[model samples]
Target: MDSAGGTLYLKDEDIKLVINPGSIEEGKKIQISLENIWDKTSDPVLNKFETIVSPTVRCGPPGTVFKKHCILSFPYNAVNEEWWEFTLLVKENFQDEWRRIKLGSDDKDIHFYLHNGQCVVNLIHFTNVTLLGYTINIMKAARRVKFGVFGKHSLNKYQLRVRTWNSESNMEVTEDAKLFGEKLVEMATHIDLLYEDLVVRVQDVNNGWQISEASKTQTFSADDLWTKIPWRVFKFTRSDPPSDVLEATISSSQATNVFQLKISCETRQENIRSKVHFWYFISALTVVVIGLIIAWTFDNFQAFLTSHSGIALFLSGLIVALITYSIMWKLVKSATPAQIVACVFLNMSLYYLGVWMCFGFVHPLTTVNIIIILSVYIIAFLVAVVLFGEIVLKFVPFIGLLGSVIFIKLMS
Candidate 1:
């Protein structure tokens, strides 16, 4: 963060992120990343699209919403399939459903456009989003079906929630609570019969699940789903797991087909915490403990390093630390996760190597002396961070000016 906000030139992602100044104050680090989801999972949602035109770019931490939109730009090659000419941006977040985001719609929070081959978007939030292509006919005609079955129960009312939408694709759809309930019975993909003016009719419910008297003969119109996935909850009295839930018949005015749903999921609930505070607590405690240990033994380490050879040996760690920090700087500028991880491990190894050198070459090892050596190495690591980062410059405001004239003389 800087006075006028900051821009991340994510060269590897071929994306740049611009943060509004007031959103984050000066001298704070913002961690954001883009991941290619294609390599990660065999997402069933991807199959529903005509073709995925671009690799899914996941800007993380997942599900982060911003007060104001950030500028997200992708290079020409980022989504440059031949199908891109007829593509739509399909976005998914922590929310399970994938929705279509239209192109060149100025009012949309997720609008994107191709300008001289570069796709630029106003990123309103962090989510996994990809450019998805649809057939020209499918784009011209929105006649597809996305259907699901969700389990529900309240006292004796054992229920099966049948949800349906136009299914061509949707945005502005709220997550269905029944499908993601405290006791969710995951159903396999629902059978769909694509037709205009379709109606879902419940013919029968048997084999341990009986249709409640109120819903047995009633029919549900697809017109109700035009605006959203209207929940058509049908309550059925049940005896534990049902061998058959319902025999649903989907019909248009003059045609029909039987769509049966049966999946024996032992009703389960996924209890996932969206945010983690445990690691942050552990990290803070470790830093405080390390600081206290260093303060306790730093005097002895200072006394031993008063001579020329000892000073030379101590300064030698700086050369290695400086090189490691430079590599980390480059990796972070581009935001390559794997390389950044490797760089951090290498830096830690080098930090420990300094303590080893102190024990091996200059002094006899003891628990008391080892703590002193560790403290010296820790201080050296902190000095490297101050030199290589903008932290000191931001606080002092004129550190560069003051240090330039006296750096060489001070080092000597």
Candidate 2:
């Protein structure tokens, strides 16, 4: 047996044969083997010389079809002597049944039909007899390939999977292929998803903190033979736990492939509450500073100021409470409308306190005293306007009210 040329020769005691290479490809190896015949139903003499030729062929990759042709040959004497018959069988795998290559009318005795008896049975006109080897064409099928991120979390872990299936059916088929490598992080800290020619940004939406430049991204490619998509790991700052929703954008060149993933952050409530409390304390300190400045500058009017100290202290406390509530409302995510109303009421009280203090300090109406009192009033008004612009307008009504009260009290 010649493996590369698909030729065979048998000169054993029981058989004398020769197989010539027909249309077999040059330098291509075809597998050949012999088997014993045990079935009594078959002809004993003909079955003794049976031989099998097996060759493994592949249809080109993913989306193509290819055809291959070959031929088998035998000794011319075997046909004339009638000692045995040859059977040519081909199969793709051991589990499949062998397909017989049928004999065609092209088979003829080269010596008897052309040169007459001048050539003996062994000395045929043609060196070897030929049989048509079956021609098989295989078509490669196309499949739909899908890639996506399966699961992701703030822990900086992501799982990715790729699936391929026949475009016309729901069944999934395996493909022995690979996906190209890509860099998901550019310049280290910025995590990005680039797929199908589009780039999507992964953002830390829950916590207000931006992803730090020192953070790193890790990627894991799929180990499965079929799925080759890569998963990305993004490390965000964990000093403050993530917010209620952690979001990232997934986009592709095609608009239909764009989507977003939102994951819940279970550990964010405590962090939010702490921030609210901290801002509230800051607002309270701001109010106390304003109150002390007012008290210290009015030392010359201590006797008169002491008489109204009760109202002054009550108004100062009201201003502090309003400032704290407003700050908390802005900082806390769970604040209610009732808390907003309370903040508004406290702001109105602060405005009234500003008007009352303005009148109390300017009552004597001396030029020197007016300069000092007006300067303090201007400073407090600017602070309120800068820090709490939304509630600062409540002081407008107090301006008119103060005028009426001061005129009546001083004239009477």
Candidate 3:
């Protein structure tokens, strides 16, 4: 079709990428063949591009709907490179076409990128011939996957600048989901205790592919990677398998208590692992006693602090540390002596840090206030993310004890 001012025009469906742009030394030639139309019924039609284009069929009365499918193929002959890149120019109807339709301005060229291999283009069009305007959809499957449109139909005519976007929704809950409920009810042994079950879920969130048993290397955004899982509900049983598949098991037995697992920022492990720890009545009482002792110590030494601000800072630190320890307790019901000792020391250090900050142990000359503020904010955010993690541990009697022991040692 000819646009107003004698400019040439191509429908959106006809958009194609070119390959093998000639070098500066020699002229380059590219031949585009359009064929193989697919219908709405999923049937394919192999036809020549020239045979399908008719002036009468396209340049009709305004507001007419028109649709067609075609594949554009081109050959490549570059000295070394396998692909070519160029912009596709689109123009609308011939009669007064330029006035009725709008093409992208020079500043924003509609460029095309093509590789040497054969490619397919699916085109669909709707035209208001009287107005000399058209709506077009082009699906470009080339070395790079891209779908685009070009037409002066109207402003806001194309939202997001592209069309023909399709997504698959595979969220059907099947009969197997019922297995989760039945297992929970069957495993319940006492009113005060509940059996926690863990079901591993694995799915491709993006276009990336995943392997079954093989370690599937994947990258996640910082937010997605740091997002916390509900450890209170599902305890990590065994090490995460080195595959995309999730392995989670729940047990009423204390030995199988679960721990929260996070993706390591360094290695980006193929599978995230969580360990299960046990809880017992003895552990819970011990934790509660330590908490009381710490509270008393703070009360007895209230006047001994050098600065009120430092005291406030120390109290804040203690609160944050206790909250974090509580969360860790809920995360693990059992642990080795080394783990318990490590958690306890970490908690003590935090408690002392609170006291020191309030008492001005960290000198203002060192710019410690800035560091303290930032640290407090981080701890608060983390605690919010793992909200009620420790509370969940208190429900399982024996495991709850173990969780308390870990929580207390970590805090004390």
Best by TM-score: 1
Residue 339 Cα positional deviation in candidate 1, in Å, after optimal superposition? 68
Sort the candidates on lDDT, descending order. 1, 2, 3
Per-model TM against the reference: 0.30, 0.27, 0.18
TM-score of 1: 0.30
Off by over 4 Å in 2: 1-196, 199-262, 266-272, 286-294, 299-301, 309-311, 314-316, 319-331, 335-350, 353-412
Deviating ranges (above 4 Å) for candidate 1: 1-140, 143-146, 165-182, 188-195, 212-214, 217-220, 238-259, 264-412
lDDT of 3 by residue, 92-194 (tens): 3334322212222242212213344322222222221111111121111111111111111110010011111101000111122233321111111111111
Choose 1 or 2, whichever is better by lDDT. 1
| Residue 194 of model 2, lDDT score | 19
Task: Give the alpha carbon lDDT tens digit for every residue of 1-412 in model 1.
Answer: 4336567765644656676765544565557665544332423254333444344566777766665677766543222233333444544555476666666555556667766645677766776666654434322323234565566533223455666543222221224452355233433233433223445455534455566556654445433432234556656554445332333332222144445544343321111111112332343345435534443454464655575544654454445445554554443322323454455445544544554454454344456644654465446545755566422212111221122112212223
Give residue 316's error in model 3 in angstroms: 13
lDDT of 2 by residue, 1-412 (tens): 3323332323221112232443234554434432222221221122211311111111111111112222222222111212222333333333444444343223232211212201112211212222111112101111122333332222222222222111111111112222222111111111221112322345444453234443332223212211122334343433244244434443322234344444333323344455445555554555445545544554354664566644654565556555655554453443333444355444544554454454565554455644554455556555665687424433422332333233324422
lDDT at 201, model 1: 52
- Determine which window of 10 residues in candidate 1 has minimal summed lDDT: 267-276
Candidate 2 residue pairs that clash: none
